[model samples]
Target: MSEKNQRAHDLRMYFTGFGLAVTLTALSFLTAILQPFGPVGLFATLAVLAIAQVVVHFRFFLHIDLSRQAREDLQLILFTGLLIAIMVAGTIWILGDLMTRMM
Candidate 1:
């Protein structure tokens, strides 16, 4: 494709991802506020939506696809995710332990 067409395509993909992220966020908020489900269910729904938004951001905004050119970026993304998970888990563990000690 021509340079102009490629640019347009990329812009459209970015916008599409943005739209999807917004929609998912709205749905998550609505589900939580409306109390459409119990607490556990709401948590599950929110988690799913959050994960989907992450995927949209990765694909559209970060342009991190499975192509050969994106391999290094993909590895970086994976490493970032691992770091985040570890931090989150550690925080939760520490907070829970503190709460238990307080009790």
Candidate 2:
């Protein structure tokens, strides 16, 4: 393909991915408002959808692949996950303890 055609094709793919992400995000918000499922189910579904959207954005927009730097990318993702978990757990623990003490 010509260079211009290739660039246009890439742009189209990017826009398609972006449209999907936006649709998924809007659906998430709609679900939150409608509450078609219970709170737990709704939240779970939303979380999964959001994670999927993140993956889609990474794959399509960021163009990070498992070719060479896969190991480093995976390590970074894992470390970020660990940090998020620790922060969430610590917040819950400290808040729960504080509430108990206050009571």
What is the Cα-based lDDT of residue 37 in candidate 1?
88
- The superposed Cα distance between candidate 1 and the true structure at residue 78, in angstroms, equals 1.0
Query: Tens digit of lDDT per residue, candidate 1, span 7-78?
Result: 999899989998998999999989989988899999999999999998989898888899999999899889
Q: Which ten residues in a row have the lowest lDDT in candidate 2?
A: 62-71
Candidate 1 colliding pairs: none
Model 1 residue 81 distance off true place after TM-score fit, in angstroms: 1.6
Q: Candidate 1: which stretches are off by over 4 Å?
A: none
Model 1 has how many clashing residue pairs?
0
Best by lDDT: 1
Q: Residue-wise lDDT of candidate 2 within 9-103, one digit each (tens)?
A: 99987998899899989989999999999989998989999998998798778775677867698678779989999999999999999999999
lDDT of every model, 2 decimals: 0.92, 0.89
